[model samples]
Target chain A: MSLQLLFDALSLGGIYAIAALGIALIFGVMQLVNFAHGQFIACAVFALILPSSQAVAELGLGRLPTPLLIPVILGFGAALALLAEAAVFRPLRNAAPVALMVASFALGVALQNLLLVIYGSRPKAVSLWAGLGHPVQIGGAQVPLLQLLVIGAVALILAGLALMLKHSRIGLEMRAAAQDFGMARLLGVRANRVISGAFALSGALAAVVALVMVAQTGVADVRMGGQIMLIAFIATVLGGMGSLAGAVAAGFAIGAASALLQMALPAEARPFRDAFLYGLVILVLLFRPQGLFAPAGAKPRV
Target chain B: MLSQHTIRRRMAASTPLVLALGLLAFVLLATTMGDRATARMATETLIRVTLVAGFWIFVGNSGVVSFGHAAFACVGAYVSAWLTLKPAMKGTLLPGLPDLIAAADWPALPAVLTGGALAALLALVSGAAILRLSGIAASIATFAFLAMVNTIWANWTPVTGGTSSVVGLDRYVTPWVALGWAVAALIAASLYGLSASGLALRATREDEVAASASGIDRYRHRLLAYVLSAFFCGVGGALMGHFIGVINPDAYYLNLTFLMLAMLVVGGIGSLSGAVAGVLALSLAVEGLVRMEKGVTLGATTFALPAGSQEIIIAAAMILVLIFRPAGLLAGREITLPARWVTGRGTTHNGPATDRRET
Candidate 1:
C-alpha cells in the first residue's frame, strides 16, 4: 500500500513540478503571472482531437505517429503562447504588474471560451497509449508503468533544464533577465528574443503537461487544466516565485502533502483535503512570505 | 474666483458620487422602461456594481489584486441562506446547521446585514494575517484563502448542502434593492478613498518603501480596506442569492472572481469611477452579445453568432482594451465634469484645471 501511494505521490508531484516550472520560467523573465498558462495546456490537449461537440474525441494529432505528434502539439502550444505575447503582452509591456496580470487573465478567458466554442463543454475521452496504464511490478510493488515514466521524465527534464541554464547562451540570458531585466537589457541581452524564448519554453512545458495529463486521465476537458494550474501557481509562489528548482521542490512537497492528506483523512473528511492543503499554504505564507526557497534579494526589502 | 474654484474642485472630488448617481439613473431607466427580463438583468448588473465597488475598495487603493473576495460572498450567501430558509427545509437540507440558526427565519434586510457582518468579521480575522504579505505573494495567499473557502463550502454538507444548490431564497432583491446596495457601496467606497487611511494606502501602493518611510502602516490600512470591502461583497453575495432565489458554492468561485477582476481591470483598477464604469460597460457588452447569440434581427434577416461566442468576444474585447489602453478605458481617471467646462469658467484653483487622480 505504501509503495503504491509513493508512486501516486511521485506521479502527481512530477506533473505539478513540470507545470510549476512553466509558470516559474515566464515569471522569472517577466513579472507577469500568466493566468492563461492553463488555457495553453488545455489547448494542447484539445489539439490532439478534431473540433467536435461530441463526447467521443476523434483523433487529430493523436492519430499521428509518436515522433511527429509530439512536435506538432508542442509547436502548436508554443505558437499560441507566442501569438499571445505578440498581440496581448507585448503592447502592455510597460504597464503595471496588475495590468499585465489582468491582460493575462483576459487572454485566459478568451482562450478558454474559444475552446468551449469549438470542443463544447463536455469531457471527451482520448485513448492515447492506453497500454501504458497496465501495472508493472517492481520489487514486489505493483505500480503503473505510466507513473514510473512520469517520474523518469520529470527527472530528465529537470536535469536538461539545469544543463541548459548553465551551458546554453539563451538560457544564460534568461537567467540574467530573471535576476534583473533592465540590467540584462543594458548588458546586451536581446529583450524580444529572450522574452519570446521564455514563452516558447513555457508553452512547450505546458504541452508536456497536457500530454501527461491526457495520458494519465484518458480524457480531454476544457476545465481539466484549471485545477492543476491553480496548484502549479501556488507551487510557484511557495517555491519562491522565480526559482525553477524551488518550484520543483515545492511542487513535490505540495503533491506529497496532498497524497498524505488523502490517505490520512477519514472517508467523510477526504473531500475536504484541498481545504486543509490550502490552509497549510496560508500557514506557510505567513511564516515565509518570500517563499520557502526564495533566492537572496527575493524578500521584500522593507 | 475662489467660489468658482471650489465648485470645480467639488465637482472633481464628487466624481464617484456623480458616477453613482449616473448608475442609479441608468438602473431606474432600465427598470422603468424595460420588460421583466431587462429588470432582472439590471438587478444582476447592479449587484455586480456592488461587488466591483467592494473589490475596488481594497484592490484599487492597495494595488493588490485579490482573487478571494468571492469567498466572502460565498460566506455571505450561505449566511443569508441559513438565516432565511424555513426551519423545516433547513432541518432537511442543512441539518448540520446549529439549531438557533436553522430555526430562525430572519427578514431579508437583517439577514443581508447579518451576512455582511459575518463576512466582515471573517475578513477582520483573516486579513490580519493576510495583509502582512505584499504583492504577488499576497495575491497567491488570497487565492489560497479562496480555495480553502471553496473546499469547506463544498464539503461541509450538513450546513452548506455540500456541492448542491441551496434553494428557497426569498428573491427579495429587485432592481431597486440592488441599486440601493450599489449606491451605498459606491458612496462608502468613495468616502473611504477620500479618507486619510485610503490616501495612505494609495501611497503605499504607489511606493511601499517611501510610504513606510513616511510612517504609513501599510498592513493596517490594507486590513481596514479588506474588512470594509468584504462587508459589501458579502452584501452583494446575499443580494445575488436573493436575486436568483438559489445559491451554490460553485457560483462564487473562479468564474465570478475573474469576472469581477476583469470588470475592475478593464474599467481601470486605480479609481472608483473605473470600478463603476468597468461593471457598467462589461455588463452592457455582455448583455448585447448574449442578445446577439440569441439572434438579432438585422433589416430583412436575423443574424447571430454561435451560441458560446459571447464569452470569446467579451474576453477578446477585454484583451484588446488592455492592449490599447492598459490603464483601462478610464486610465485610472475619474469622470469629473469636462475639463473644458471647468477651464471656461476662467478661474484657476490651487491645483491643475482638472484634478484627474484624486485618489
Candidate 2:
C-alpha cells in the first residue's frame, strides 16, 4: 500500500515540479508575474484532445501507434507558447507594471471564456484509453502504465532543462538579464528576445504538464488551468518566487505532501487537500517570508 | 503669494461639499417615490458605492491596490450578522439577550456603526502582518489572506453556517437608511481626502522617498488609513449583507473583489470623485447597456449581440481605460481651479480639459 501510494505521489509531483520550472524562468528573467501562464495548459489540453476525439477515429489517426502522438504533443506544446506571447505579453510591454498585471488577468478571463464558448464547458480526454491498458498489477502492488510514462517524461524534461540552463547561450543571457537588466543591456545582450524566449519556454512547460495531466486523469476541463496555475503559483512563491531550483523543489514537496494527505485522510477530508496546500504556503510565507532555501545574499529583485 | 493661495484653496475646497449635498438631495428626491422596485434600486447601489468609496480611502492614499478588502468586508459581514442575529441581541431572530443584558438590542443606525468598528479592528490586526510587504508582494499576500478566510468560512460550519447562505434578517434598508450611510461614507472619504493624513498618504504614494525625507511616517500612516478604510468598508459590507437579506460566503469572494477593483480602476485610481463616478457608471452599465444587447436601434443596423457579450464589453472598457486613461478620469492630478467660478459654495465649472503638459 505504501509503495503504491509513494509511486503515485512521485509521478504527480514530478510533473508539477517540471512545469513549475518554466514559470520560475519567466519570473527570473522579468519581474512580471504573467498570471496568464496557466492558459498554456488549457491550450495544450485542447490540442491533445483533438487527437483523441471520436472524430479522430473517423479521420484515421485513432488506429495510429502511440509513438506518432508523442512528437505531435511536443510540437503542440511549443506552438501554444509562441502563440500566447504574440497575442498577449508582447503588447503589454510599454505599460506600467500594474497595467501589465491587469492585462494578464484580462487575458486569463478572455482565454477562459473563449475556451468555454469553443469547447462547451464539458470535460474531455485526449483520447480513449482503448489500447493503453489498465494498471499493471505487480506482485503486491499496482502501477499504471500512464503513471510510469508521466514519471519518465518529467525526468527527461527536468534533465534537459537543467542542461540547457547550465550550458546554453539563451540560458546565459537570461541569467545575465536577471542579474542586472541595465548591465545586461550594456553588455549588448538582446534582453527583449530573451524575455520572449523565457515566456515561450514557460508556456511549453505548462503544455507538457497539461498533456500529462490529461493522460493520467483521462479527463480535461476548462477549469483545469485555474487549478494547476494556482498550485504552480503557490509552489513558485513558497520556493522563493523566482528560483527555478526552488520552484521545482517546492512543487515536488507540495505535490507529494498533498497526495500523501489525500491518502492519509478519510473520504470526508479529501476535499481539504488544496486548502491544506494553501495553508502551508501561507504559513511558510508569513514565517520565512523569503522562502526556505534562498541564499543569504539574494536581493528581492529577480 | 502663499497666503492668497491658501485662501483660494480653502474657498475652492468647500465647493464640492455643497455640490455633493445638492446631489444628495436630488438623488434622495428622485428615488423617494415608487414601490419595492424603486426602493431596491435606490438602496441597492448605496452599499456598493459606499464600499468603493471606502476602498478609495486606502487605495487612493497608498497607491497600492489591495486584493484583500473583500476579506475584511467578509469579516465585517459575518461579525455583524452574528452579533445582530444573536439570540440575545436580535428581537426577531434572537428574541432575548443574556440574563445580564436582554434588552441591549441595538437599532439599524448603531448596528451599522458597530459593524464598521469590528471591521476596523479586523483591519488593524491583519494590517500588522500585511502592510509590511510592499507592491505586488503585499497585494498577493492579501489574496492569500482572502483564500485563508474563505477556507475558514467554508469549514467553520457551526459559526458561518458553512458554505450555505445565511438568511433571515429584517429588511429595514429604506432609501433613507442606505442614502444616510452612503452620504456618511462619501463625506468621510472626502474629508480624509483633504486631511493631513491624506496629504501624507498622497505624498507617499506620489513620491515615497521625498515624503519619507520630509519626515512623514509612511508605514504607520498607510496602516492607519487602511484601517480607517476597512471601517467604512465594514459598514458597507454589513449594509450590503443586511439589504440583500441572503449572502453566502461565495458572494464575498473574488468575483465581488474584482468588481470593486474594476470600479476603482474605471473611476480613476486616486480620485474620490472618480471612485463615485466609477460606481455610478458600472451600476448603470450592468443595469442598462449590458442588458441592451438584445436591441438598441443604432441607426439602421440591427446587430445581433453575441453570447457572453457583457464580459467582452467590460474587458474592452478595461483595456481601453488602461490604454487611454491610465490615471483614470480624475487621477491624483486634478486641474487646479482658477476660483473665478466659485460662488459662495458652488464651484460648478466642470474641470477644464486635461493638462496635456502634466505628463
Candidate 3:
C-alpha cells in the first residue's frame, strides 16, 4: 500500500526485465538456452565488485558520473558474451539443441565454480552505490533515488534495443537468421557471426542488470547468477523463448509479482514467491504452449 | 568408421568384461560398505539409478527429453511422506481424520507402498493431462508438473513441512535392506532391457515413427516405461527417507535431477550396466570429492570451496563424453554373457584360448 513499496516493486521488476531481456536476446537469435546465462550475470556482478570496479570509480570513467558506469558494465558484459560464444557455444554449433543445452548448462555450473575459485564464495559488495548518496522524499513517501535511476536506465536501454533490432544491420541479420536459418544462410548471412553478436548483446544486458541490482542490494554473491538464470528462464519460457518483447514483459510481471508477494504473505510464505511465480508461468505454458505474447504464435493464442 | 569388423571385434572383446566389472563393483561396494553408509548411499543411488533408467527408457526410446521427472519424484516422496506422516499427524495436525488413521498407527510398510502407488497415481493423472503433447511442449509441461509439485509442497506445509526439510520418520535403514532393493532394481532394469517389450522399447528408441508404423503404440509404451520408472524412483525415495532420517524439499532440486542425468550420459545412455556404472562411479566421485574440499574464514569472510568439486568434475566428464561418444558409453549395446560362453557357435583368431579371458 505504501508508495515506497510500490516503487521498490517497480525497480525490482526493472532489474528482472533487464536480466530476462539479456537471456531472451540470445535465445531470440539461435534458440540456445545459453545455460551459461546465469554465469554471465555472475561474471558481471563479480567484475563490478572486484577492487578494479572500485579503482575505476576512483578515477577516469568511474568517478565521471553514475550514469557512465552503465556502459562500463555493458562493455564488460559484451566482452564476456563474445568470450563465452567463442569458448563454449561456438564449439558445439553443429550439435543438437539438447546436446548444446546440456553442455551450456554444464558450462553454467563451471562458470559458477570459477567465480567460487576467484571470489572464494564470500559475498562482496560493489561500491556502485558510493556516489548515489541518499534517498529522497517523492511526494509523502521515501524512495531511493538510485532505484528511479535504474528504471529510467532500463527504459533507455529498451529504446536503444528497439532501435538496434528494428534498424541496425547486425540486428537485421540476426532477425533474418532467426526467422529462417537455412534461408538466411543461403542469403549470405553468416549464421555464427549474427548469433555471436546477439550473445554479446545478451551478455551486455545481463551486466547492466547486475550492476543496477548490485547497486541497490550492495552484495554480490555467486548465487546471484542462479537466481537470474531461473528468472530469465521463466521470462524466456513465458515470453516464447525467442521473443524479446515477450521476455521483457514476462520479466517485469515476474518481478512485480515476486516483490508484491513478499508483502501479500507472511514470512512463512515468502520463499514460495518464486514457486508461485514459476507456477503461473507453467499454467500459461499449458494453454499457450508457444508463449503469452508469442509473435509468430500470436493469432491462435489470443 | 574403423571397418565394421574392427568395431565389432572391439565391442565383442570389451563390452561384456566392462559390464561385468561395473555390475560387480556396484554389488561389492553396496555389500561391503556395511550397513550404515551402504543404506545411506545405496538408497539414494537406487532412487537416482531408477530416475536415470526411467529417463533412458523414455528419452532413449522416444528421443524426447522430459524435464519434469522431479515432479514425479516429488509426487512420490511427498505422497509417501504424507501418507505415512498422515497417520502419525492425525493424532496431532489432522485431529479431524477418523480415529482409525487418526488414532491408529500403521507401520512403514503401508506407507512406502502407498507412497509409490500415490506417486504412480499422480503420474497417471498428470500423464492423462499432458502426455498428448510431444517435443518441447511436452518437456515444458513436465517442467510445469515439477513446478506444480514444488508449489504444492511449499504451500501445503502441514504435509511436506514446506521449504523446510521434512523429518521425524521412524525407520533406520540397513545397507542389507537397500542392497536387496538395489538387486531388485538391477533385475528390473536387466529384465526390462531384455524383454520382448524391451526390444519394442529399444525399437521405439531407435525410431519412433518407424516403430509406430510397425504397429507399436508409442504413447502407450512410453507411458508404461514412465510409470515403471516412477515406481522404482518412489521405492528409491522411500529407502532414501528411511536412510537419511531427514527430507528437505531442496534435495529434489533441478540440479539434483541434472546430477542423475550427468551420470547417465557419462555412463553411456540406454545401457543397464552403463546406468549402474554411472551412478556408482559418479556417486563415489562426487561424495569423495566433496569431502576433500578445503575451507577458510577471516573477519567478515567465510570462504568455502563448497561441495562443488564433484559437480564440476561430472560436468567436465559429461562434456568430454558428449563430444567424443555422443551415443553414450554403451549406447543401446548390451554386455551379454560373453558370446562364446553363452553360445559356443562362433570362430577363432579370437580363438578358444584367447576367448578364455582369464588365461
lDDT per prediction? 0.88, 0.70, 0.67
| lDDT tens digits, residue span B1-359, model 1 | 54766676666666765776687778879978999888888999999999999989999999999989999999999998899988999888988998889889898889999999999999998887777777887887787789889989988989899899999988888888898899899889988988899999999999999999999999999999999999999999999999999999999998789789888877888888888888988898889888898898989999988766876777787788777877787888777765445545655556534334222
Score candidate 1 by lDDT. Answer: 0.88
Model 1 off-target regions past 4 Å?
A300-302, B1-13, B299-301, B336-359
Model 2 Cα interface RMS deviation (Å): 3.2
For residues A86-191, what per-residue lDDT tens digits would candidate 3 score against the true structure?
Answer: 8767777777666777777777777787777666666665566665647778878877788788778888988998898889989888878777677898999998
Using TM-score as the measure, which candidate wins?
1
Tens-digit lDDT track for model 3 on B255-298? 76678678777776767666666776777777556655655556
Model 2 interface DockQ: 0.29
Interface RMS deviation of candidate 3 = 4.4
Model 3 spans with C-alpha error above 4 angstroms: A1-13, A50-68, A117-144, A253-271, A297-302, B1-25, B29-47, B78-105, B125-134, B137-158, B162-172, B186-225, B294-307, B337-359
Interface root-mean-square deviation, candidate 1: 1.9
DockQ in order: 0.67, 0.29, 0.22
Docking class of 1: medium
- On lDDT, the stronger of 1 and 2 is 1
